[model samples]
Target: MVAGTVSGTAEWSRPRATHAEVTVGFGTDDTTVQVRSVTTTVANRTELTLANALVDTRLQFLTAGEADDLSVAADGRTRTYDRTVTVTVTLYAGDQDTETVAADVPVEIVVTNEPGNSEESGGSNAGAT
Candidate 1:
């Protein structure tokens, strides 16, 4: 998460994309509790965790490097993966005076290896269909 991006009285829902590779936020309104930020604490795909730059779910396609790192074979230079992630989310109260509550949220990660869809390209291997 950015230094000053998520530290303040949020007038509206502010989504913070942090190490979790998901938007974690804390905000509120008059009705039900609102969700702002979601941080993935654990992921099956460890390589795409905090050490990585790409956010979970947000990027539904794996770059060549990512596939190589995951050792996920590319079928016809294309492939897709589905994984689960454990995340922490914040629930905000309608009354700003009330302290924001933290909640647990589950996240699903899906990615398709599309050619020329990532930042860089290099790992080009063939896999059986």
Candidate 2:
């Protein structure tokens, strides 16, 4: 993870994606507590903890990458279009006053393209005389 600066204040904002996909997590930290929630501000300050208050989740990103696209058949009456999906993970401290931390987590995004449908020809049954 790289130490950087963030600007904004949000209790629950969308995660940041690196190469199209967005993922959020903490830095090199490990804990046993489970994250309850996360909060952030325009200044890019995140705070998080655990609901149980036992241990910290120590949120952090493992890995991230791009996924494949979905495929669809196109019809003559309708048109085909391309679509994509991005995924990301966020680390939370599980505290109301705490903010959400961001890291480069592993994620996959899918892109799909719709194709046209094919027409069928008229035919008789083989048993028909």
Candidate 3:
């Protein structure tokens, strides 16, 4: 995540990723998240842009067989799993030709299973009829 500030400000504010292209790459798939391309905007803040960008790239690295293997079910309900993926984010300055910074970042994603409401069970529910 890119953060910046002008300083000398009382209240802190979240830095915006402006004037740059965020490129996420996983294996052979690569996708660029533009500043203006956002899934949702709340109070002028972009939501899920970075997250969606990362997921899109990660999906390319998975094959049909690999995806099927990763899916699992427990107690007749699918369970979510966490996977750590290595990705590279390239930051450009003004233009793609001008590469200002690049880094390999590890992204952890929670892969959700099929839609189902799961009931919580444990010590308290052990003896409940």
Candidate 4:
């Protein structure tokens, strides 16, 4: 099985819709290899369910007071953080639940602070008075 990488950016002050290129695959191209379930370790961070896209996934950029500390780059203009997200998928054969395959893939999440990217723009208020 294989999974794609995830990269996202947010402002240090506000939240934004998370972004990522998520892809899941199997070793064998079996038509019956359907996905029974999909989950991620960043479910809470992304505020989303791996099940469907019905809900919104807003990201809270690496703020203060968290297990992972924020990294300041370019002299405090940008704050970044790295996180590992595990995407687990359960596959089953068509019309049969007994034959199931489970796979876990760890994807890295790099969230950096972008300048001027707010609701007004994207996530920055630098130009604001």
| Best by the TM-score measure | 3
Per-residue lDDT of 1-129 in model 3, one digit per residue for the tens?
121111110111232323333443332125432222212122222222345443333234344565454554442344443333332333332343222233344443334434444366422221100
Give me the displacement of residue 31 in model 1, in angstroms.
36
| lDDT per model vs. reference | 0.30, 0.26, 0.32, 0.30
Error of 2 at 92 (Å): 18
What lDDT, from 0 to 1, does candidate 4 have?
A: 0.30
TM match of model 4 to true structure: 0.25
RMSD of 4: 16.9
Give lDDT tens digits, candidate 2, residues 16-116. 21112122333223322121233222233232222212123333222222111122233222323222111122433332222223333222222233333
Query: Best by lDDT, which number?
Result: 3
- What is candidate 1's lDDT per residue for 8-82, written digit by digit as tens? 121213322222323343222322222233433322222223222223323222335543444434543543333
- Rank the candidate models, highest TM-score first: 3, 4, 1, 2
Each candidate's TM vs. the true structure? 0.23, 0.18, 0.27, 0.25
Alpha-carbon deviation at 82 in model 1, angstroms: 9.6
Q: Which model, 3 or 4, shows the larger lDDT?
A: 3
Worst 10 residues of 3 by lDDT: 3-12
Candidates, ranked, lDDT? 3, 4, 1, 2
| Clash statistics: count for each candidate | 6, 29, 0, 6
lDDT of 4 by residue, 18-90 (tens): 2322223322222222222233232213233343431223323223443233333432254333333333322
Which residue pairs show collisions in model 4? Answer: 117-122, 117-123, 117-124, 118-122, 118-123, 118-124
